[model samples]
Target: MKIEDWFQTLRSKAETIEEKWSDATEQERLQLADQLFYLRQVSDTVVDLWLQFEERLSIAIRRIKQMEGQLPVDDKHTQVAVTNETSDKDSSQSEVASAPLKKGKESTSELKEANPYDPVFRRGEGFYHLRMFQDAKKCFEELMQHAPDWESGRLYYAYSLLFCEEQEHAFREFRLLSRSASSPTVVASSFNAIGCILAEEQQWLEAAQAFKSSLEIKTDQEEARYNLALCYLKDGDAQEALDEIEKCLQKDEDDWESQMLWLRAAQLLQSMDESAELAPPSPIQLPTRDLDTDTLQEMASLYESVGNYHRAQICYHFLTERLPREGWAWHGLAWNTWLIAGTKRALTLMKKAISLAPDQDDFTFSYGWMQLFDGKIDEAVRAFRQMLEKNRENRLGQSGMISAYEKMGEYAAAKRMAKEFTEDQEPYVRSLGYFHLGRLAVVEENWRMAEQYFQRTLPHISQLREVPIYMQLCASKLGEQTSVKELLQPEL
Candidate 1:
């Protein structure tokens, strides 16, 4: 059957089910709900696939735009022989495909080279976007055979697999990406996908954990948060479920899904309360206007420390209302914005913070990260450099510069910066330098060297989560017999 025919058939089936619903038996309606749920899941999964693929699509489109009029009369697509030698041949294909992976966007003129796989990707992506998952699966299978390492192709493949009901295969692909993808966005998306698969299997605890992990990697993903809330409800944590729903509502008060979840959570809580004889908590005065500035700041900082960014944001918002030009309040608010809304809006908020207090190293560093995640690598680098120039004692600035250098593929320059950091008088600063040096070594596939760097810094910076993570990653790569759980966390 043609892709259109099958898609239309599914639509026809849904229409028939809806038409019969008015007179259907309870059991029949349940069956219909199952079918509708499947369709809804497929739609949600494919939309996520397209969101991940959109970056590749935009890059491919830009490159094609730059290479206009240079195409051959016959733009024939051929399946290149898959082999170890393909790495060498990638240079002759799309320049974008061959470039070292980074989060930031590359300029089109810098990489306009064509590849046969680009055409295949466009075709697959087109089918994938149209809800023709079966045809999309075939196209992505071919793309995978051609370029197995491309995360975007793998994402589409996994998404199509889920729609095809190949749940096990989809889970494996998503799990792999979550564990090893270089980009945080890709890793977070993979974790969210894993959560969905686990949730479908009725493994509510595992699914909730996956969603939490996704949020830990990138807190601003609303879909993951919603899934986490649903999982909490399923896991019988009514109050926790309500908290997650409230966070979603904070983003969009009118969000129908969040409102529904909130209602469900409240009902669950009420049912539990009716059954249990719990004592009522003591009440306190609400929303006093006489709170001092320092008290408000402390409250915001305390909430921020506990991952209660919404509450922190509320306090910061109140502070901003009272102290319109205060950079500290704006800076705190900007960080929460990053956690709750992501880089697009956070970047603008951070710029306001930076402009108000050009002298605060904390604000400057925060602005640089906001810029970096927003894909403005050069601007982020400048912010980091400027902060370092203003005060050479600022270790965060040095670390930021090292990170930006690695993103830009300037390993030698990054190494130089790392070395300078190691020479810092402060042990904490030196630990950061060694930590970044370890990261650079890992990037170059020098597992043993990376392990040594990690070990040297572990005592000083083990408090920072990434130190143990890299140490475990290096240990695993060096053939050490260690539980891989420690790769993501220091413990189980």
Candidate 2:
């Protein structure tokens, strides 16, 4: 459909959805939310396509306001471009006619002008946007054959190669472009792309050099700096990593990834056991106390997610100084301290958090888990039971209770809870169930049963790093000569 028609259709559909939402049941409301999520994805994809459709018509899509959306078409933009091209052609033609033209150069220009690659290029781009990488690669491959000097076509071809898992070919092509591309922007991007590929292969030294080349070309290359810092960290230059990430934070202090990297670098520099393992950073606090509340909260949460509990505790400490009465700040601080320091000191903090926010289930759940972690079986079981009494559907409470049961040597109760968890809707929960079952089997010296349980877990959530470690332990018990050579992880 035309742009206007599409816009109107979207607006009408949005308004109808909004009108239905107020009166819809819970299930229907959830269905509507899914619909909106998919629609937003479609909108984002279309926006990306439009940004690449033409050089001048980039602002065709903009942010929504209230319930309305706008997509302005600049008709005059195309007209002006065509007019300027024609004027330039006429001027060039006159100059050529007046002067003694070099026939070879003229013929070369004519050959370029006559090349039938525009449609092929556009088709390749369409396939690229639709995520049909093989088809895009074929089209771009044809373009490369016919127009070998076309850098844009080569760039697209490289991207398609990467998308198609032909990373070696993509790396070679990008490296070529990085050294020989006419456009500064393309050259910088090529270097960055090369760095990413090398970084994935764990060639940190080469990757860092590539990123440095990208930075030399474009001084404001933030992504290159981020990549370079990661490379530096991996290459055993924690000080350089810290310095590079500091530059990123200087430009954008709210960059949570930069803060995480900064925290990581500091941790590495201070750690005695600086191997491949990701340990929490040292100094226990940030150098500056000038970060805003939201930035600090996000940094803390990010650190928590990545298991840098020490860094999270540091953020929470700063937060308590600013928002002492906030229960969540205390709760966050309490958990991280328990994780990094000890449960003894964290117990008082957990109590304070509970007192301030008695209604928060997370605080209750953590309090229970902390007790369980500290080997206070009776207290942990009671706390978990209390939480479940208030809300039986509490997944955390159920999980904690199961662990408590296992600790208390109540195999029957633990097995029952784990069986229920196996029937849970979420696959991750099912994996957890199997994991607990496997743990129980290990405890009972049922090696074969434990192996089967962990094998079942692999299909559900293979990415959980602990699953393999447990499996390896089980294997060793069964007298199978196996070793964990490497733990493969998705890189940043």
Candidate 3:
């Protein structure tokens, strides 16, 4: 049977088992659970086998193309080899005529081998390891023309380019690799390379952004943190610089660059403090006192906006302690905690926020969304319905209801709620409408309509987890290949 048909039959059997197990004896339920576990393992094994088959097929196709001379050759490398051969044969006319013949032989010999374990690649990598960057660059430049999708070879080529002081070429190569590479380490390293290029050009803000992107992908990159701190110092944001440097020091206390940068930032802050003490207070300055809950709340919002979730969590934590009745403080704390902790803790905080502000549509809607994220679909539906009763125009509540219904397999109800929000002016709300409609189309096996709806939603909600996967599935059903690797890229 086809994979899709087999999946449909398996799903029907699973549903039947679930229905029977719900009313079964304890022993029967235990047997059903064991069967379900075995089915899950079988499903995982099938997916792994499919992925392996796809990889082997891709390799076979590439080899066939290379054998047929369909792959592009490196003309620069070929021309240089030809020119040298012509120079050696200039003394004899007969030899010169045969030079063209010799050139063809040389060209064919110089062509990169189809094997991944080709000796030339190892030689190039050996040269790179020995710090012979120019030689390595030459080898990689030729290798890339033959195997452009070889990620490790491409990354080494970019690194060689950077070491050779070809910053522009290196930056472009790293940027391209970051977009195409699936490994988080490779993507983070690429961003780090781009950051180094920007830093060398004295583009502090851009460099900071690049370093932040790198650290977001792989937070253990101490080098990226040190570079980010240096960029912040260069931009005169001493506090932020100090904070980043302190984080680096925590990871590696003996890191010389981080240690020096921390001292410099500390001195700058101290000097600013001394200068403030010597100068008269500004007319607009507020009276000196302990920070109030309102001040802490504002600071938390600012920190959260800048992706400083740890600091935001601290501020919100203090606010919650100082003003226990403040629902907004609890709400903000939940969001900040959600970034640092997981959904369960965030759900607990959100519940407190909703209880403190029962009339607040935002709190109630957020609670419902949290419930949806935690897989409490029935509870989420009830919360969303309650929110909708309180405020009929709540876009988030409407979207939540549609999502809950869709998750529960209530396609008709999901479609009805989706239609109600389809004309909403908000971009996210309208996007949710198209998203649920696409999901319904998928259930109905209408691949073309699903593709159309997903395309409409992509511009507004491309970041949704299910969007890229479903889009790729639809494309596959239509006999087109589409990469969905970017959807799995890690973020802060």
Candidate 4:
């Protein structure tokens, strides 16, 4: 029986046992008492089972949200690889200029089938949105099996496997996609995926070449542009990175990710310039305690920018103590303090922050994150669950749920929740999920799978720039011999 159904049966047994006690003889009463005790025990057991299932489902749901956030938003570009013959038969032929148009009948047939209100291709999109790769993979695989050569199904299946860290399989699929597609967008997206894979292997030069090829196929694809810039930066070509990012900004100004890349490129260029000049350094200007909170925060950020966690903490501590309810301040302070000290102090401060501003999702998330870091998995789950209840769309809450589930060694629950919360398929979320799965696989001595997960995770390094260097150090313990260089390529 299902867990809930079993629980109901036990509850009914307990009710019957209680009801039978009213008109019993002494011997019958004694018998009824024993029966009642057994029923109570059964009830407790069933209740425990229900709680366990509920907890697992809750954790799974949270992870699903987190994973969904990791998926790319360019759903328009997420197509399955199909033969040219298929394209010729479909209306995508007119949409993609390279495909030779069939006579009027094919176009008419496509138009007749096209229902603006219908979402025929959205069967597993919810799973895809949630970052439930295996579930999404299953859905897409079934779709392809049922409707062979459906481009969207094939693409989504490959995309799901990308999260599963099946690098070779995903890469092969993309290669086939690139070879067969008439659409420049499809070709560009395929090349981009391949470039990202190469980057995971730390083949920076090759990655750059692949990204360039993708851009050649479709110059307007911003992700490819940003990734190519990252490749340039990795190769110590700051000027190229800077120039490329500048051009990218021309196409989309509000792309904060590209802006951050531009910032990194600019910083690298400045470093290169400084190295060339051989000039004496200027004397440092120390700030007094009377400095404004904004200035202090700025100083802290600058220290953080340079990887100076100790100095950053000092600044954050001062700022957060003064502005106790500032959620971001508390978050900054907790992360830096965790690095400088250990998770203990970070936990304390995060708790204080949460108490000071009980409703702030960011502070709640930080507290949960610190708890997870401290190995307080149950506490982390509570904090994340509360955060999610407050706002189902909380990214940090979703990420924290994934972390908590992983810490508790519930891999299936973790994978399920990661997808549910990360609905957008942001690269960072994908990276984080892959990172956890990689670590888990390594622990299980599944080295090949670990290596593939790590490779899939490489494109997300830039998203994790703020993550402690030590986490990477720990993850690098996988027995696989993949180059670290390949895994640091920026995927934006």
Candidate 5:
């Protein structure tokens, strides 16, 4: 075969190896390891072949030199072949030697480049996990210098800065990333970071704008919408807040966090409504009193800030009714009324809330909870079960459904759900499940079993002034008694 053809084959193999290494996953890397070994073998074979050819050419040249001295003249074809042989040897040796040298130099350069920045990235990850934000920032700064367009790295760096309480710098970085001519995901993520930062700073209007930008780019982002709704609430734009939360609920219909945020925002709007009734407007607007909705909204907020849920609810109720289409007033009524009347009345108010804002997951969940509290066991069960169908991980819906099942005397179903729910690290919900089991035993006149459940409640009743009375009753019924006086003894 011609040396030129052999060189072309080597070049093709090198190019294939380069391509494989350029974008290799773990599985691909394992497969390419074998290919790499085969390439090395071929390279070694080519080197040996070239060396042998050079050796033969060198011997022939020496013999030619001796013969030229012995004979008067040489054959033309023979002289030409010797000259060609010498040229080929020189060319082949030069190419072969340069090929290995070039590869070694490239490998060394790549290793040096990687070594300088790899540790910085690794340190950044470690510090981030440990919540050492300031230390993480230094590493990320190094990484940015090495790979400025590294999207994931930049995002982590921005978060580190935010966590370190460097909001201004983080905002600048996020702004840069959002406007960069890069992947759309980077832009969306930057907006998300900006929204979070603005929310933390209580810059509600700017935060809402950032979250809106994020949601427009990626509509399924529940956190962004939830944060946006919170910003609207902060800015005294209850209607807008309600709308954003509903959008979030549409994306993740069972997200309790988003649901809670919406419910709370709705409650604020209701407070605004109630305050409108507390104090009548003067026949003429006061010069000092700003009549903008923002200032008007503050009246209900002031009542709430004073721990007066009654007045707050009253004010929110009035403000919300004026805009009957707005759901926040009804939500406020439900939340405040529930605080006053427990779960039963809360359910009715939540129904009103749902009527005003039919698509809100938060109101729906609260309504189901009210039904559960009202002992509308089957209806509560149905609502929560339906919610779980949309999001299997919905913690509140699952717990509410389980409680409904327990209330319905489906002890086996309730027990199954309780077991699943209790697997969470926070044991309060799981303990409540146990308490419910004990109560079920009591209703069936299983005094001994009731005593067991009542006993379980003892560990969780520090905040309850009446739970011990029930515990005493359970003990008395079971004839394994502790007195109310004994149960109520103050903790040392």
Candidate 6:
């Protein structure tokens, strides 16, 4: 069937479903919900395919037009008539496309002649909107160098840096602009940018304050309000998040992100109400009005270390929500959730962490470990290899590679990696090397060699939980009950 016909059929189906939905019984409604969910997924897939086809079709048409340049005419009289007709049609179409840009450029030229600043700033804005970050950056940098006090140039320069992922430099520039910009709107925007940077660092409280400051300066700054709501959600204040998001929805009901956030906040609030025992304690009075970032981080770390995973989850959730761009926050949350929610859910969170910061060796190493635990040896191997390529000295990456190779039954590669790590300077690396070798020895049923390798590992990493387990197993195989008893002691 034609694409249009298929779409029309889907539309009719949707209309029928909608018509039935209002009159349906509760049981029927439940069944209809499942059908609707599946239908939405199918619709999304079809839309994506259609968009891809449209893009390809447009490119083909452009190529054909280029190839069919200057069509020949049968006679001179016919050529004249055809040329006149075609020229008029083509000129009209060309004029329509170029008119807005041409008029804009004319007005811009007049403004530039009347003003002291160069017209390149406006050109840079056009490039920025076109997503040409490098070109925009160059223009803004040149403008800033020539007119150092120009707030707009500095603001755009910082934005260009931000889009290009020079985050640290962008944060510094934004901070400077926040303090120095004479215009209130520019200062507010600078504050918003600063809040974004703080959020990227997982400083939720500080980010919220930054957004609040921006809102105070520019009351109608919708972006700041939305950001503040996100910060509230991160901080586990569901009611506050709901309230902020509701205000956004009130302003624009069709905003999909705000709608989603509103639902999330409402659900969270409902869950909190349903599980009274799981709710957090009331806030304690502090000497200061607000907690510092360092204090909040320390509390979160302490909770995680003490096995208070629920509390740790709250802290990490706040961090991740406030600083969605920060890979470490996501990784921390994944680890905390893994203790309670199991590997599969944690794996999804870990993947999000990896996507946000692919270059972070630690995040990549953890992702590989999770993949390994999920029995995805090939994927784990690829992740480990990628991490090792970025930082060859990454001990976790090397350890993951050894584990992945062992799981894949590539004993030779695993043994080679074990030998390489055993010779490394770091005690932890050497310990891991010995541990892998001991495991391999056990696999081979060489009890004596396994016991010896485990013994070697013990001196370097006596506190390691797995080391004692392997030591006891090897000793049991070697018919040494005394060593097993000693290794099994609680004090040991």
**Highest lDDT, which number?**
2
Which portions of model 6 show Cα errors greater than 4 Å?
1-292, 303-308, 482-485, 488-492
Q: Note the Cα lDDT for every prediction shown.
A: 0.70, 0.72, 0.68, 0.62, 0.61, 0.67
How far does residue 189 in candidate 2 sit from its true spot (Å)?
11
The lDDT of model 6 is 0.67
Could you give candidate 5's per-residue lDDT for residues 1-492 as a string of tens digits? 997998798788778878888689989888888887888898767655654565466447546765777322432211211011111222111111111000000000011112346456555755655456687789889888987766556766886787676879988988998887255555666787787666666677887788889778867555566667777777778778777767766665544345445545555554444222222112211112223333334545554543456655665566565656778767876777786778755766677778878667677778787777777777777788777888897777877876787677787887677666546666666566566666667667787776776565555554333456667777777676676657654456
Best by TM-score: 2
Give the CA lDDT, 0 to 100, for residue 223 in model 1. Answer: 68
TM-score per model over all chains: 0.40, 0.50, 0.37, 0.40, 0.34, 0.39
Ordered list by lDDT, greatest first = 2, 1, 3, 6, 4, 5
Q: What value does the lDDT take at residue 164 in candidate 6?
A: 75
Clashing pairs in 2: 267-281
Off by over 4 Å in 3: 1-312, 336-344, 373-375, 443-446, 461-466, 476-479, 484-492
| lDDT for 212 (candidate 1) | 88
Distance from true position, residue 87, model 5, in Å?
Answer: 71
1-492, model 4: which lDDT tens digit per residue? 896897688678777777877877899988888887887687556545644565466446535644787323332333222332222223211211111111111000011112221132343544554445677677767766665455555666666677677989989888887788666766777787777777767688987887888889878766677778887877789889877877877775644445545545555554444222221112223334676686677667655654557766877878877887676787788888888888877877777767767877877777777677777888889989998887887777877877777777787877676555334567677677676666666566676666666666655555444222323444566433433343343446
Model 2 stretches with alpha carbons more than 4 Å out: 1-224, 227-257, 261-275, 279-287, 305-307, 459-465, 485-492
